[model samples]
Target: MATEYAFDIASDLKTVQALELLSRHISGLTLTWNGKNRDYLVGSTINISVSEQLRSWQETILEGFGFTPTLSVGFRFHNNTDFDAFSEIMFQATMLLLEHAEDAVLLFNYEIIVLQRLGGKLVFNAGYQMWDDDWLKSRLSLPFERRPLPSPLL
Candidate 1:
């Protein structure tokens, strides 16, 4: 078993148009807008958590890639596996991000301290109680924030 059913990608989408590129590649993917962001032509994030699981009988596919950055990124993923599936996805997601930024440093933190299931019972169980206790927050790209300042009154 592995960790995670969803993945979120962040990058500058102006020249790369990352969302469009990824949308074409990922299966069972959808592009959503929250109507809360107003940054144009700079940064875009794509969330891609899938319900599919990679069967243990199959070999783990390693992309052999990622980045070397130094920024703080905080994110939590769902733990959907009974074994190391969660850890494997952690590596996979790192590679996925590496494919985009090519220069980031991802550290696991506030992890495992993290989802969803449906049934008539609607039961919930949480493992890795202290998941993020250590931490692996990453620095994907250069630290960047888009903020519009007010004009001065003359």
Candidate 2:
């Protein structure tokens, strides 16, 4: 059976900066909607939805990106076997936003929602967290070496 899950992130990074970071880091995976290629440039919005159902399992992926000086990236994945993969991707994206806005004291907020059917009824579990620069830095592994450098020699 397919499950519904979503990750919503809010950060101070500009749309262009966020988009650039995602485009660079998440190149390995193709984020398309319904298996169709879509243009997601700076200042542009992206919304993709795809679904597949087979026998005992159904899978769906919905991803959207919006730019408004502050960037919002939402990812919805159904029946995901592992959450680590999702966290890894979000971590990378967050790190990129932080790197771009160095001097700015930024805030980060994220929410995860999972929906499941129980007893023939739909149920959802949702949680959200907000953190400042200090807390985020302390809780997250944002090492200097992991950050992208303009010059490799640096």
Candidate 3:
């Protein structure tokens, strides 16, 4: 079986705004909209989608984290590819969303990767064992705070 890699973020940003922001900041990806769903094809390898609604359990979990999510952005990876490049894009995308949304939480493979609240403060997690922000920062090379990335209009 192929290893499954997925990331989901529950955020207060509207679907349109999320799509727009992602399309602008993350380069070399194109988003095609169909009704409420937006699909991003990453070099014919990974398929990404935006979900406007959340399941009851998802909502409950977000609330437990002190977040009131309005919509969810989900990325589903179906095939193997250049994982390093994929990770970079995912990191950039997560930062972009967290920067713009007031309350947002990201889940990787159904595990909480990181979360932001009150518009600025961010919390990082590595499963239930490790909760060190430094570890996460070094692993992903992620900045402790938000920073601007070059945006190429989509």
Candidate 4:
């Protein structure tokens, strides 16, 4: 069963502020939810991993408050994003959550960045990426090495 953490984060604050408040309640990476769960980005998928780390948190910090908070953290990630990009963020987020699974549920967002050459002295960075399964319109037709550099599927 899910019990309130007793700290209600404000809705009106900017994204960064909400992050700050949330960190106070449960330190580490997390995703913020908008009303009705609409904040979820389009084309995202939820992946969950279970481990002994989660067990330790529930038994130590949460169980004492009459809160038997038992859960694998939940959130979403873009389904079509590149594997390498997702892997990097996933690795980091998972490690963090497992380390503090007792503190709170983690909802984290991952973004990738790519740097490319522009004019002689200028460098351009792309915002998002085209992944393997992306459609006919996808630029993935090119090889990962030959392909234009990719950015995180933010």
Query: Candidate 1: misplaced stretches above 4 Å?
Result: 1-16, 38-75, 79-93, 110-154
- List the candidate numbers ranked by lDDT, top first: 3, 2, 4, 1
Ranking by TM-score: 3, 2, 1, 4
Q: Write the per-residue lDDT of candidate 4 for residues 84-142, one digit (tens) a residue.
A: 54433443433333333322322222123221212111121223242233331242232
The candidate that wins on lDDT is 3
Runs in model 2 lying further than 4 Å from the true structure = 1-17, 31-69, 102-154
lDDT of 1 by residue, 1-154 (tens): 2222222222333222443444455443455544442111111222332122133211111121121122222223434323343343344444444355423322223121121111111111123232232232242232222222121110
Alpha-carbon local distance difference test for all models: 0.29, 0.32, 0.55, 0.31
* Candidate 3 lDDT, 1-154, residue by residue in tens: 4433333444567777777788888777777876545544343444556666567745664555655566666665545677656555666777677666666655555444443443455554433332355545665543454332121111
Better of 1 and 3 by TM-score: 3
- RMSD to native for every prediction? 18.9, 16.4, 8.5, 16.5
lDDT of 4: 0.31
| Backbone clash count for every predicted candidate, in the order shown | 29, 0, 0, 4
44: Cα error in model 4, Å: 9.5
Error of 1 at 89 (Å): 5.7
